[model samples]
Target: MEKKVTLPKHKFHIQAGDTVVVIGGNSKGLRGVVKEVIVEKDRARVEGVAMITKHMKPTASNPQGSLVKTEGSVHISNLMVIDPATGEPTRTGRKVNEKGKLQRFSKKTGNFIPDAYRKQ
Candidate 1:
């Protein structure tokens, strides 16, 4: 018998497509767009960071195996979302707008972050 694996829903301040800066690890000081949010693993795949090489087996697409480069996930704790308003790193906070809609804001500048996923 095989055990079933389940992924828990994780609410992360940083979402996909948000620009973030690495605060720790070898990728520290580097910035990139958030490609994906790995909620189950508590990590995020940032563009141009934590690159790794993978060897692939020969397939119909290619006659020979090839080495492919891809981005690996960085722990969520090591990332800081960049505030578009200030063009700098900032901590995120949640607030209810005048319309009673939940909004994400930058703690440093006290500015609301425009989120596409959330309808206003």
Candidate 2:
């Protein structure tokens, strides 16, 4: 048998809990926090952004089927990270920060982008 090789993992531009704006699709111009990132599909689920309805079958909890509402996945390319400093959507870039570690920064304003999840 031949040896199998694995490719490098993809680095997502966005992560969980990052505030983002939907630049396209039905939720265009809407802002929400990133709930989760679906790396396999390059999609991100944003809270209060892509509202989808699902028809559920009857279960022990209920005799009749019910409709479930939840956030839907949006393509990563359609989402833009909001710059905390500028309060505007801006492209992100990775650069070495003061701690000598790679950090995401706002390309438009040259400011370090703080990790929204680290504070808490």
Best by lDDT: 2
lDDT of 2 by residue, 29-68 (tens): 9999999999889999999988999999998988798999
lDDT score for candidate 1 against the true structure: 0.90
With a 3 Å backbone cut-off (N, CA, C), the pairs that clash in candidate 1 are: none
Each candidate: how many clashes? 0, 0
Residue 55 miss distance in model 2 (angstroms): 1.0
Which candidate gets the maximum TM-score versus the true structure? 2
Worst 10 residues of 1 by lDDT: 111-120
Task: Identify the runs in model 2 with alpha carbons over 4 angstroms from their true place.
Answer: 1-4
Model 1 residue 85 CA deviation (Å) reads: 0.9
Q: Put down candidate 1 lDDT per residue, 1-120, tens digits, no spaces.
A: 999987667778899888999999998999999998988788999999999999999999897989999999999999999999888999999999877988889999998888745564
Those runs of model 1 whose alpha carbons end farther than 4 Å from true positions after fitting are 1-8, 116-120
